[model samples]
Target: MTERRHDREFVRTFFTSPTAVEGEDDSAKMLRRAADLRGLEAPDVWVPDNEDATAPSMREEGAENVAEVVADSGADFPGEIHPRVVWHRDDPAARYRGFQQMLTVADPDRGAVDHIDGFVIPEVGDIDDWKKADEALTLVETEHGLDRGSLAMSVIVESGEAELAMRHLREEVGKPTNSLERLFLLVDGEVDYTKDMRATTPTGELPPWPELRHNTSRGASAAGLIAVDGPYDDIRDVEGYRERMEANRAKGMTGIWSLTPGQVVEANTAPLPPETGRWLLSAGDRRVELDDRDGAWAYDGDRLSLDETGDDYRLRVGGDERRLDAEQLREELLGLVEYVPSMSDVVDSMEEFEAARESGTGAIAIERAATLRLDGVDVEISSDRMWDEATYQAAMTPIRLFQDVYDHRPDQREELEERYGEDVVERATTVG
Candidate 1:
């Protein structure tokens, strides 16, 4: 028994290191360790990983990869849920990864907040029709469920569109039915779009630009697009990177895309983790406070912002601190605000979304408009919306049946629980 007590204490050490990344086995060990530390028995099972792990929601893998968690920013907090993920499919538009920035202004007339999920830069390289090559946005409101944002037109100078997107989003904030859940941005140039992308229509802003989040914000924007090709002849080395952050912080380009995984941590961290100054990957669910909305702001595990001054908040991961600007004064400071989603909702949604990919009926189309727009010619559009019709039809058989299954949220909950287990199902919640 005495030895058992020592074993219990040993296990608790890893249970709350506050830096552990949860995986299939890791979470279970954590739960068991936590219980053992307290001389209690862990639940009969371990926590699940991903959507299949829980009721579905709190477990949702954002609408797209590299998403900003709308729920608790804290990865370890009891009530944290990963919100919707989003992204923009790679196209010629992606080439301008760093040079493009969309300033969306909320439509003042709508009197509602137009939360921006992400932005797309048009590939004007050859394709013309603005709409065809333009960026599409996804803005979520509790009412509309999860749908597209209001603006998606191509722009001439990056500055003009950037301003307008902001106006439109803010304008829609006051409307009666608008809770403007803010945004869900997908940042990346991680992957390129190809004719073979016969899966689900690529839904996102850009690819992962872990560097950009570290830049300064124009306002309360969640995700943003920025082009960072400064002729700073100095930014070729590690010191150059740090120097660039200081300079850009002054100008407001937080981070850049031309980054490596190794560089990610240095650009995202505050006090600069001993390992990497970047904190986005290194320190998650850690407490932090940086500048935002003018003065010093705080993110109470739930809402993030400085409605006033001196709000003591915690760093919950997801927010990046590196940038082209503001690297001058290095303070071992704060980080991320958070959001906790419902237990099964996100998981259910993900399962349904995956099933929907099986539907071959919704393919990409090159309408007469697109034909008029394309110059390179060989424009092939698929109705599969990215799903492999043959495979989905082969496995699921009934297309309609599978399509319908994608719409069922509750069923996904059960599926998730049965597959991944309960660790995911029992994450932190803001519902109460």
Candidate 2:
């Protein structure tokens, strides 16, 4: 059985520091590494391809490690910033009110710090204190100017009231507040809260957080929550990381963080699937519909581009740009036995399979109720494929052109194939 399955599908990641500690500008380079681990890169808006993104430019550990994230995507750093120096509280940018900030990604056209879409901060002292934390968050939600329906916001919950923040996220997002995408709690340290306590009490229980966000939107993820803390959890004692991930999932969380990109495959994928569908696509009479969308293609027959998200590709199966329905989800699980060698890789490869559903547009029965309000059809994606669902989620993570924009360079892709094996992709299907 594949091990690391999840239920929630629609998700994205946000990288930020709890507080901009003294002389800590060099920290944000961690986000760049985070994107790479998931087989992803920063959007073009944050960093253009022509620019040199060598490792040296990264913010090094210093008295104040000022980190910078530059990007490309026609989206400029909303404020003035440079990659060379760290932005401390004294920097004039902190004085402003209600301003959403981005990191300056490297750029060929300019010399200033290139920026990526990131929340800026003068400093933060605690995560558990919503009383004080709410001030910046309220401003962040309103000032972000993000489309309420299509985006997720990361709320750093660590102060004593961190659990309260998580519960608030479940009810407040996509409702009256309509400001959040998911509740990914970033625990700054290995403070043990193993058992549900008064503080780390899970969200959505009898005693819910203040102002529940009852109203949801289309194309939104169910209130998937997560916990990420610990350093090098992979190489050392991964069991603890797994325990935390599963614990959070039990508490209605969707995903967790990995110490390295290599672990992302395992961290994201479920190491197990139901033994019944152990080797075949059918999940107890369900359709395991697999399509060949792996190779380079384009929408409107014009060749896929960095800007365009996706186009309906009518393959052997039905078409609507692309697809990865319940059936395909089943097949990915079934194929795991044939292609996936270990439990960890089985979990890692789940990302590709999950990404397929995002290529096409559909009204999944599970999605109908939680995210899209489409309970019109009956749906059941059994827990048989544990590798597919986040314990807290019941839908699929859609493919975003934001992610498909960049094709891995040949050598790098070859390295992926070498690492995971040719079978990592679909069988008998041609891929890059």
Which one wins on TM-score? 2
| lDDT (Cα, tens digit) per residue for candidate 1, span 1-432 | 111101011100001111123454342332223222211111111111222122223222212111222111222222112111111224433322211212111222222223222232321221222222232233222133434434322221122223234334344433444323223211212223221222244674333323322321332232232223211222247666665555544443433322322232334321111211111212344444322222222223332221211322222224533321122111222112222223243333333445555564343221111110011111111111232344333323122222222232232344434433455433211111
lDDT of 2 by residue, 232-255 (tens): 333466665566545444443333
Off by over 4 Å in 1: 1-163, 184-216, 219-237, 252-261, 269-432
Overall local distance difference test of candidate 2: 0.29
TM-score of 2: 0.36
Looking at model 2, which ten-residue stretch has the lowest summed lDDT? 367-376
List RMSD in Å for every model shown. Answer: 28.4, 18.4
